[model samples]
Target: MQLDLTTFILEVLNFLVLVWLLKRFLYKPVLSVLDARQQRIQGEMRKAAVLQEDAARLKQQYEARLADWNTEREIAKQSLEQELARERDTGMKAIQQSLADEEAKNRVRAASAIATREAELVRNATSGAYRNAAAMLRRMASPAMTLAILNILLDDLASLSEKRQEELHKAAHPENVTTMEVVAAHALEESAQRKLGDAVAKVCGKPLQATFKTDTSLIAGLRISLGESVLHANLADELGYFRSQDKNV
Candidate 1:
């Protein structure tokens, strides 16, 4: 509590010296260490920022590549689907065309078969008709029928056209034709033969020699032969003609 100037002054001087020693050794070294640590921390922070920027750029690039891959996959899928559809259509059309062609061929074959069968039936029917006609005519043949047909033949020769008469005249010329033969299915009376000879001579425009014969195979009417020319008015010849026509059918 008493005033001690000299002692206070000595204490103050010792305290100042201690403070100077501390600043020179401890304080200076501690400040240097703190500054170095601060510098190192700042360098580490800058490195971290650079790493973050690189990571962001890499992520963006990965995202862009993924989008492009997705687009390409979609396009490939659509193209494959279109190609499959086109192939299916082509196959279906080919099958349909083949089926149509087969159907047409079958129809043609059926039509041909039907036509052949019909033609055969017609031929059979016509043959039967001709046979019946021949049989009926054979049953009706007789001497009386022959005489009647002979009269008709005489009438036809008498009424022949001018052109036909000329043909007969030329064919039965006296020098070329030695004899004009007349054959009948039945025997003829002398008066009938003379009348027939006179009628033939008149048609030939000159007198002609006559010869007569009989054959029952004529069935009816007469046959007149002059050289290579022969004329028949007979049921047998008629029936034979019908048979030939049937065969043609």
Candidate 2:
């Protein structure tokens, strides 16, 4: 425990020299490595921040694009549905119209067939009635009926209008007439023929050299011919006129 000043001084000097050496070699190099590492870490952090920002922007863009695609798809789907609906409606209408036309045609055909059948039935009934009347008239024919009809004919000739008398006179003239005849279903007496000829000649304003003949087809009356004109007071002619009217109906 004696005071050793010289030794203490040397110890102090050595300690100080060691400290300087450590600071210059170890501490300086270690400090440089730490600073470099710190700068590299800071640069990496800055790059990571930029990458994160870019990723966020890309995500936003993708989301927006996806939304636009969904909207377009919905619009396309709606348009297709609307088009199909219109086509379906048009097709249904067309089918309905065609069915209506066919039904109308069938109705028209049915009406026409019914009308034809009714007309045919009417024609058949009328023809049968005419045939019955004609048969009855043929059975009723007799000489007395013929005489009565001839008398009636003479009365009609006597009662003719002045104009009709003049027409008969012109038609029965010798130059115009080719043949004049009195036809009957029965034979007449000479007195009756003479009386009829005189009456006819009086109407014609001249003598009519009329020839008389019997024709059973006349049925029950007289037929007087003057040129193209023929006057009949006969059952057969009356029946024929009625039949012609029926046929026209």
Best-fitting candidate, scored by TM-score: 2
lDDT tens digits, residues 117-202, model 1?
A: 77667666666765676567667877789778878888999899999888888888758786788888888878788888888889
Local distance difference test, per candidate? Answer: 0.81, 0.82
Q: Against the true structure, what is each candidate's TM-score?
A: 0.54, 0.59
Can you give the lDDT of residue 11 in candidate 1? 83
* Local error of candidate 1 at residue 107 (angstroms): 6.7
Candidate 2 lDDT tens digits, 176-246: 66457988888887878888887888888778677889988878888898887788778778777776786
Task: List candidate 1 stretches off by more than 4 Å.
Answer: 1-120
